[model samples]
Target chain A: MSGEMYIPTYQDMLDAHERIKPYIRETPVRTSAYLNELSGAELFFKCENFQEPGAFKVRGASNAVFGLDEEQAKKGVATHSSGNHASCLSYAAMKRGIPCNVVMPRTAPQAKKDTVKRYGGNITECDPSTSSREETFAKVQAETGGDFVHPYNDPRVIAGQGTCAREFMEQTGGLDMVVAPIGGGGMISGTCLTLSHQAPETQIIAAEPEQADDAYRSFKAGHIIADDAPKTIADGLLVPLKDLTWHFVSNHVTDILTASEEEIIDAMKLTWKHLRIVMEASSSVPLATILKNKDRFAGKRVGIIITGGNVDLDKLPWLK
Target chain B: MSGEMYIPTYQDMLDAHERIKPYIRETPVRTSAYLNELSGAELFFKCENFQEPGAFKVRGASNAVFGLDEEQAKKGVATHSSGNHASCLSYAAMKRGIPCNVVMPRTAPQAKKDTVKRYGGNITECDPSTSSREETFAKVQAETGGDFVHPYNDPRVIAGQGTCAREFMEQTGGLDMVVAPIGGGGMISGTCLTLSHQAPETQIIAAEPEQADDAYRSFKAGHIIADDAPKTIADGLLVPLKDLTWHFVSNHVTDILTASEEEIIDAMKLTWKHLRIVMEASSSVPLATILKNKDRFAGKRVGIIITGGNVDLDKLPWLK
Candidate 1:
């Protein structure tokens, strides 16, 4: 179900960029000769994994937390998340000296919960169900009188995410194509928003896991199609497309490509080996897609967003 | 056992920097707030792990390969190394389209041998003993008529390595202290050479694994103390210092520090956790020493040389 929200403008993204510049890192873009030889494409990786909270989610989270007026900020912000967004929001809120409440499923990994708690987030656990999460979140927000910050569907969050691509363009000058993993479509929508306005000649490519290929189907059907509980190693991309994200994804996206779980993990390991950097499985989807579809990207200067680096060290898939 | 050689001057380092600029990566200097807070100092990691051949060794190897005269170049280059130097020399030679002969120990890790072969180096395995290795290397050089390029002992290699610290100074402006792991004293000697000439006000600190603390003992004894077979997880730092390396180490180093095996591994894991980059166990010695000697480094801007990222993935220490 696509949630209805005001479409963020180019000016909104610019404002978000200015607002969040001080709090976030201007993460470096890295390249690897071995990776280029493998794909036959010159690739530049925008390493958001180097962000303080260890993910690009901090960009949007910081923008949302900082954009709140003094009165609203005092009430603080709340969200229902069990991933990087939860930790990033808590980190941003803590930095702003405001309270943050997160509604997480009780079954969420302890490592995820610990990260949120480490950032001073107050956790309110619900059963692993959408109804339970919504009911618990509503009560928590009511008790705290906090503003709800939807992870991807909110205009402010999407606008905040848009700044990443803006920075990418400035850093690399320009790229022939930009690729990013599509989860709830926050990062992808942000890419579309920025590139469509700033660099329309640059194509936007969304990568998805085969097990959770709703975005691919949705693109083909010309509408939003989302899976509720698709299981994949890319845990961050389990969420489906919402209307705010769908608006950008359907219109601006060049294509949605898919890769098998094995391919995704292989790409993740290869990235760790060649890039000499740690990145999560979800972030590897773009590389997986690029390797699988070399004809499309070969000889092109491609920019890939390494969305995050929040994998549980003990549970690295290769180790298993 | 130390062999005498002409000491390289400051101009040698400058020449090396200019010579290897195109062949090597001017790897980025990265910082982490968490790491800085832990050490109570601002730390800049000069990431040589990002080098094309995955180590700072490429700096020296490229210089040696490219500095050869037309006739000497036709003869090619040869060295006996079981670590980063072997692969780096091969990579540099491959780039220059010259024959590279690496005389590796028969007991050297298969992964290392594979890397040398991947770069088109002819591998000649010798018995894992000093006399055996040297004799084998001599025979190989005689048969191939290749110019000898010692891993760390040669003045050419030392001059080449000094380029890393020179770049670090230019990249970070200047630092109060510079730290690097000391094995055969190649990287540390280079650091001392560059910092002493360019940033004379900066202190040069040498870090060594306690299990292989010959350099530490040598500093205190005021004479080179060679270690025959000291064992350490930092495999890259097992080589003993020769007269050429000893000259720089003894003359310019501010202090030599040693870290326990446990401490080195912990720092390595912590770096990977915070810096979000892969680095070898040898590279983590600087951070380990900083953590141990916080009083000396507190509040200072310190540059740490992450010497390499060449680790056997299947045998990651933490996994064991």
Candidate 2:
């Protein structure tokens, strides 16, 4: 019953793409001729990494922000993120000239916070400990009368993220497999739902960080799994699973694959070297999964969604 | 009379894109929403910067290698370069299973040489002077019975490079202006000729480096102008104007604009930061021109061709 709540129809994705088209980019699809030959598979990279605010989160954020009723939208939008979503929400709301509030863990990277600031978001820093951020966000929302914008879990948010799959389908038509990184399952949930309806024959693989294996665990247990401690360079993926996302992922997903941080970093470097585009560690998760499970996808037409590109070039350790 | 020898026909470009379609990438077209808002003009980037072998040279190289007759193809290929052309030729020939030799200047960056090596091209280094590199390449061609693949002079090569324009015409059919970076004039020649026929209403602009203003001088003097010990940060644009490219450029090119090296560097950084693509100095030339001549292009639909991205990170001043 819970699973059915998240399995959206292909038509739903199409409508969502149309709704968010004004706010989000129909990011280009890049092909690697060399990689295609080497892998003996036709590969299409849906470069959501180049989306507005530099990640696919903009799709979900913009959709969620726009979905808010005039009464709710007038109060402005609030979200807990010092990452892509924070920047995305700020940018989307700024486009509407609406005030935005972001509750960021104090430990969040400076680059991400700077991004949010540039887009006119009011920032409230909170302790990194679990309870502090939510508590601070609640206080901020109470004072500002802001509507809460969940990063994922909400139907409107997942529907917004689903636009990526819709564009992928339009650009490359169909694929034998669709692979995307799984954090709290926003991207994967949208992808699995969209693929199951649009390209039923296509398999959906969720690539997760090994250190943050909550999504993988949730997939196996058919319930939400929360990890208290997570360590990985994929900072975008440290968040634990949510009940709504778990509902979609458990029913429509194929299987979850995990990649070590080192593998993710290597993939990120390879993308930079060969593709000539910046890719963050979390964005490289799908490529890492592909590297780990090479045999599972031989000769199949594969689509890889590069989810984000908010990398700090000045501090990238691997560059040295 | 010498200038008349370089003119290219519109029909040749249309045919070239068709002939080279299977072997080359159309490359994606990117529209920067922020730039559009900033300039009050819609802008499209033809990112040949992401082309195979990291630049638009591959379009020419692939055409030259594949256009060879049975006997010529069997003889293999050779060329002399200090930039994108060398790696592109080597890569094209290697993909066709033909032996390739490149006579590169000793001053050419090591990273470029490594790209040639990875594609299995035999390299013979000579001094940076044109005559010396030509002599070395001649000797290698004579000894190895290889066909010489001139970087930009040959009709086939010019026609091949024109394929990039073909794809641009396909992606963005109507444009008020089309701009391209000028080096040996190959890329712009192809573009001008193609757009002249395919999109006759479009105005064409050539953006060249101030230090290496051979193409600009040629356009002004109505003849091919050779660089006299010119210097510029755009390594791909080091060469003086070749005779064949001069004719095509002269007849169709509207005007040429030159930019300072600092402007080019700034453009490079902006492209990387905003677009997330690491474009080299040559690829940044059009953007540099746009920045310099902002008043001229206001409220117009402008298309810029980003020529390549095979830059060495270690040698980059920004990295330092």
Candidate 3:
């Protein structure tokens, strides 16, 4: 890999923001006095859940999809995701009048498949296993020649996600710390890329579900740790960190925290009760971490990224 | 009643907005492309659900609570309600550091009671009948010498509610039609008062559940139509209209529409899905009506008021 691959500068994020502005929402910064009191910290929630495609993934997806050259765009974009990234990429591609091919596990939620299809995405199903998915995705990419946009590991996608923290700093002035859930570390890496350059004083924290603590372990070990199928209700944060993400994670992230399953669920319900936003389980990890480690965040102005709102209403964790 | 009771002018709404600006939030306006396509209308949702007390009732409640004279303020405010109005009034009064006495039905939701108490409002339980509630409220008012603030009928409350429509018009640059669910007609009357004076070109529409269609019947009959303990999933909108609200509803409202229980739930779920907000079932009436009568609203700019988000999460109708 080229040295350029490791360096996605603040300028890249600025460019991504400008490029994706027309295709994405400048989602609102929301607050809850009740939540602030409960955590003993002033919390500002960057509500990416309100994005048109219902996730911050849209920002990265739109940046990558919109940045393509006419010739490259004509061939379209492809990704392997059964989560927000698939639908978000599809939405961005559809907005830019390009085809999007999403390879998903056949067992993926029907609601997710419906969203991807609704956004004009063509889906190719694979077996549930990672090897099968990879094999199937490789064949699809080779056959279609569509540009592969890795969910979080790509430099372009990382730069796109970093725009959120830029907007966050502008919207909330500046925060003492910014926390977000780590799936494949796209958002955390993006956050690190922006805050480490723009507001070095501000801390970047990555929250992970305890059950899927590969990123947490990686952060402590100073190396990438890959988890095959860690189970958590925060289905959106199932993926482990890749090298590109690990590059940012190891260098800029101040701390990586973990929340237990029960804590994550409680925080999710609390946010719904207090913020009144339909956020996903993955989004609640930051709040869960804050609540669990109140001493670390208390009395600080904290910004929490509410990642997405695309959960299956029929299979809500609390109901289950 | 005095002639002034029936004449809450646009000036009142303007003054109310200024008076309550310190206490109540100028809630964000949200939009959903999916909802726009489904209804065939461009819908701007004024999310009063984001209010501190989780409802638009706070606008009116804050106005009444804050507008009280020194002598009257000493007694604080008293109201009898089993819904958002009760907690909202309590919240407003508490913000002003005054006593708030709410006479609620004994069977009211525990969640509602907790919120009222959390806001430092004292609650008095009634027998779940209009007569009993009124009697209980009278006793509380007489004993405490607290000023009575009717849920909808009071001119102060009507003026306060009108501020929302003023903001809605400003936020979305004035819609072709502004629709809100009519219970005792507080919010609808407020919309009528503001739109009739400030934006006469904009039509004001009231929506109600078919099961509790007293507002619809009243609009058609040109008189008040009260239903005895009407029941609908939109529990916030079970009250009947009073004289003060009736004046605005009859004079300025262009239409009063009704949606079935199933339609209301469906629209509520759709908004939660697409808009990603936890709005009350009553707030979904406008979207339900718009979907039911698409030809009338198709291609038009419509403003829908998301009145509240205070619902018992444990008892979500869809889950049940």
Question: What TM-score would each prediction reach against the true structure?
Answer: 0.97, 0.91, 0.98
Predicted chain A of candidate 3: TM-score: 0.98
Give residue B145's lDDT in candidate 2 (0 to 100).
91
DockQ measured for candidate 1 = 0.70
Residue pairs that clash (backbone atoms under 3 angstroms), model 1: A2-A243
**Candidate-wise lDDT, in order:** 0.92, 0.82, 0.91
Candidate 3 chain B, poorest ten consecutive residues by summed lDDT: B1-10
* Candidate 1 residue-wise lDDT, B27-79, digit = tens: 99999888988999999999999997899999989989999999989889999
Interface RMSD, Å, model 3:
0.8
Q: Give the alpha carbon lDDT tens digit for every residue of A290-313 in model 2.
A: 877788878898999999887776
- Candidate 2 docks with a DockQ of 0.49
For each candidate, report what fraction of the true interface contacts it reproduces: 0.55, 0.41, 0.68
lDDT of 3 by residue, B1-320 (tens): 64556678788889999999999898999998998888889999999999988999999999999999988998999988878888999999988999999999999878889999999999999998879988898899999999988888988899999999988988998799998998999999899888888899999989999999998898888889999879999988888888888888999999988999999999998998899999899999999999999999989999999999986667677888
Instruction: Please give the lDDT score for candidate 3.
Output: 0.91
Q: Give the Å shift of residue B5 in candidate 2.
A: 3.4
